[model samples]
Target: MTQESATVDPPGDELFARVPTEVSVYEVSPRDGLQNESTLISLEGKRRLINALVAAGLRRIEVTSFVSPKWVPQLADAEELARVLRAPEGITFSALCPNARGLERALSAGLSEIAVFLSASEAHNKANINKTIADTLAVFSEIVPPAREAGLLVRAYVSTVWGCPYEGAVDPARVVKIAEKLLDLGCYQISLGDTIGVGNPRQTREIVRRFLDVMPPERFALHMHDTRGTALANVLTALEMGVRDFDASVGGVGGCPYAPGAAGNLATEDLVFMLQSMGISTGIDLDKLIEAGNVAEQVIGRALPGKVHKAGPFRLRRSPTRAS
Candidate 1:
């Protein structure tokens, strides 16, 4: 729909307009969502959750990260998980890699699509990957080309684009510069991450607007955390600005290992529900998406933070109890 047509509201219309019907939600609960959980999920459980996500009509499932087991013990089974997960047809399974070694392990485990991550804020970058922002980009120079040479589709992540937990109030210009470098290094898509959930609609709009000036929104993905409970709202802002791709976690199952007390990524169930309710086509079954959230919750042995995970999908009301 045209932007003007989309903005037109009849009397008593809902506040948030329905998303355009073509947006795609990429589920990352199995990988980004679970990586920072203090609770370790068993190998079989991870596999089952990923399989369930695929069954729920999610085509893009980030499988796991190939980081050092010593660093991220929760994902110690990365290679094994990658080796054993059933690759259903028409599904794209991706793994996150930090450097050449990580990419090497991912490639050996048969990942054709891989993601490398860096932060737009220097302090958060050093805290996250223990390197300067420039040094990290230099590492990508070594990591991205070889992955591309091996026929791997390389996706890059730029974290702390909105605000950093340590550094705080990151400049949009800094985020834009880092993003351009990643794009220049041949990243197919740059996942813009709000690392600590500090972004509001205004900040989100500003960052996305500046970035879109240099790169098409199609080559970008928004990875938001609900730390301040603004993830979905930030998502709405990006959507209004014509961003169509987003990163969400089933049941909101992730946090930064470095950013303490930070919430996980935006919940996939919530995002899908919002999209579907707006008549936007996500190509996912809301019921099945909740099932995937349940699977993640069950594996983690706790209650999920997603609202839909507790209240369930919206449905037509039944008549009041008549069994008196």
Candidate 2:
């Protein structure tokens, strides 16, 4: 055998541990990240970005939200975007559906996966969707069955799972209850979102521990914002607890329009870097992910919050030739 063939790859072994070091990264830049931006990306631009992401090996992508154009003008082309989305085989393209109307639109647009959002805190749900938590639950009951009937995979977004900007600290029990309801309503996975980025490792572990009591860790996903710079720390806590699915935006390009003072979701580039450093296998090409972030910045006409986008990945230089 050649010398190179004799050397075993240690990094592959590290990724094989029972605990998943590399979690699935859901790129939401096209949908959630762009929804709140002031600049409008054209239908063609959205398609170009999505195609690029798929080409870069992103299998799960949030393409758009099926909501009122009057409310979110950025995603006004949701139908067209979803219809023309040319994703690779086995690649899942999902959209955020607010209600039955939105679900109908998503079905018409040919999406097989749809995500529904509800807030744990009353004030947040009210501000975000103009409905109380109780009212939102009533809507979910109607929304879920029809979606399942249409042969779509339903994922739920439980927002403000940690601290809410308006309500301060949220009760873990409330988040758990909402998650159970969404799951009972036929959502295969519940994405717990720290809408305002106020959660730290301690709070994240506590909440995740509680959720583990009711649901398997694999059935849950974490969505964090870096408004307070604690998103990666919270992600580490979740990873240590055996949670493996995460939601992130390229270039950290999202914030809550309803939750004032909230920053963007944890950047995909930052998350991938942390996971890969620990010898995890996310199946994502880091360099391509960073390139996607650059495209996002250009589309939004502003700098993204992701540090990696600002600084290139760490590399060591070779020794320079000296005068012999």
Candidate 3:
């Protein structure tokens, strides 16, 4: 046969025609997932969770946050945790730094990758960090540079990008402007968050498209909550738009402490299952991920919101033979 006739199409070409070959799954369950829990998890429990996530093939993990214990007591052991946690090779560990103090703590703890956060809506910003958007940016301006000078990779999260509980409706233009400031402030990547989980597929598409017009897809990531059950749909929309990075909590174990009535995040297992079934690679093991979810559920002492964790992965079976 001729060379042209000998060539064969790859598997799942139709399913993944519009999807990227590989996507980055940034696991945030260690920090965002447990920040609002009422129960105080011991330092050892937290360490076990992080180690479990690492063993499950997650390369990037947000291990903890450096906020004041008064604000988020769940992560009070941030410094201690950071100091004791072992950073194996090939794994990129990150923590959230809210201000100069948090950055100082993270740097002292020997963390190389840190994340900063600000909200797009003024009302949400005021509620979350007790500052206006401009004030938060000013704080970030001071925080980002020195952190970069310290040879640290800085990532910024813009919360309430879709809608705010206090403000009701947020303007996407304002979000874009805030993102530009973050990029200008030297944030390596910007994760747009639907802090209250009010985004639909249409809104996700529009906001992502506008952002892509100004910045490359590689510079952006989606941190979606499943409050309205649209998180997975939003992920699909972003994937179609060539966006590859996503933030998910294992076992759907997170909620915004500032945004009232917001639900947990899109479960990492569910996202991985959808991606793998479509032939897109996430470098995560589904069974091990489920085990991690179980750990989270046990630690939190409640059933998680992830569908796959409760119902298990979908399977196909053969039909029975006729009795006659």
Residue lDDT tens for model 1, 1-324:
576577655663344453355788888888888877788889999988998899889998899889889988888999899999867777889998988889879988997799999888888888888999889999999989888889988888888888888877899988788878887888888889988888899888898889889887888999989988899899988887778899999998887777877777889988888888877788898899899988998998988899887889977898898787
Worst 10 residues of 1 by lDDT: 12-21
lDDT of 3 by residue, 217-317 (tens): 88989999999899999999899888999999999999798887788799999999999987889999999999999888877789999988887788776
How many residue pairs collide in each prediction? 1, 1, 0
Q: Of the candidates shown, which would achieve the greatest lDDT relative to the real structure? A: 3
Misplaced by over 4 Å in model 3 are 1-17, 316-324
Model 1 stretches with alpha carbons more than 4 Å out: 1-19, 321-324
TM-score of each: 0.92, 0.92, 0.92
* Best TM-score among the predictions, by candidate number: 3
lDDT of 2: 0.87
- Candidate lDDT scores, in order, read 0.86, 0.87, 0.90
Which whole-number lDDT from 0 to 100 does residue 130 have in model 1?
A: 91
Model 3 worst lDDT run, 10 consecutive residues? 9-18
